[model samples]
Target: NLCSKNKINPLIGSAGVSAVPMAARVSNKVGLESDAQNFLLMHAMGPNVAGVIGSAIAAGVMLKYVLAM
Candidate 1:
């Protein structure tokens, strides 16, 4: 809904946090369904990787504090 209102690609949000390449591939597939020329895999991958890194960092921080206790 937000993507539709903001005119942003829904794939960015959908592919940001899980399944990494799989989500990007799914987004690319959906984009291709709409327009064969609209290739979005690369774009989706950017946020996907960033999300994974951010999640990893957060997990590390949480684990560090948990272990200290």
Candidate 2:
């Protein structure tokens, strides 16, 4: 819904910590529906993993800041 409204790729839009490989799998499945050759699982991993690590780093930074206050 949000991806369609924003004109974003489903795989890219769905990349996140909780969603992770599940979202990538869904993207690949949907892509295969449209085109049998489509395989997005690996491609989606970069963003998915990055989102997880980035969130952890962000949380750490936020925690440090809050603790300093």
Candidate 3:
């Protein structure tokens, strides 16, 4: 519920101007094949093992920041 609210509310607030498509366009301009670009996006953003790893890395960064403080 919270995730949906956060995700939808932002899109509602910023309708028609999202970074996602722009990022994809820039990625495409970089000469990546469509399939390779999509695979890279999945590795970065997909709800799978790689996303879990990203979350873990983010958590570690937060933990380090807190410990430093």
Candidate 4:
């Protein structure tokens, strides 16, 4: 939604999952299919990497609390 509002392809934004570079590659491939010059890999990767790290941190926190309980 943020990407859509900002005028970026939603596909790229959605690629920001915990899957990392694979998702980014898929986004890039899809973008290239639409337009040869649509380079979205690097842009998508930014969010992808962050998502992985964030997910890891979140999981750690959840586990810590669960184990404590």
Kindly give the number of clashing pairs for every candidate: 0, 0, 0, 0
By TM-score, the better pick of 3 and 4 is 4
Query: 5-64 in candidate 1: lDDT tens per residue?
Result: 567777677788757789888989999999889889899999889889999999999999
lDDT of each: 0.86, 0.75, 0.43, 0.87
Q: Which residues of candidate 4, in runs, are more than 4 Å off?
A: 1-6
Find the candidate with the highest TM-score and give its number: 4
In candidate 3, what are the lDDT values of residues 1-69, reduced to their tens digit? 555645322222222223544443443434345344333333222233443566678899999999999
lDDT of 3: 0.43
Clashing pairs in 1: none
Candidates ranked, most accurate by TM-score first = 4, 1, 2, 3
What is candidate 2's lDDT per residue for 23-62, written digit by digit as tens? 6777778888888887777877778788888888999999
Residue pairs whose backbone atoms clash in candidate 3:
none
Query: Alpha-carbon error at 55 in model 3, in Å?
Result: 0.3
Which sequence of candidate numbers ranks them by lDDT, best first? 4, 1, 2, 3
Highest lDDT against the true fold, candidate: 4
lDDT of 2: 0.75
**C-alpha root-mean-square deviation, each candidate:** 2.6, 4.3, 12.3, 2.3
Q: What is the lDDT of residue 54 in candidate 2?
A: 88
TM-score of 4: 0.84
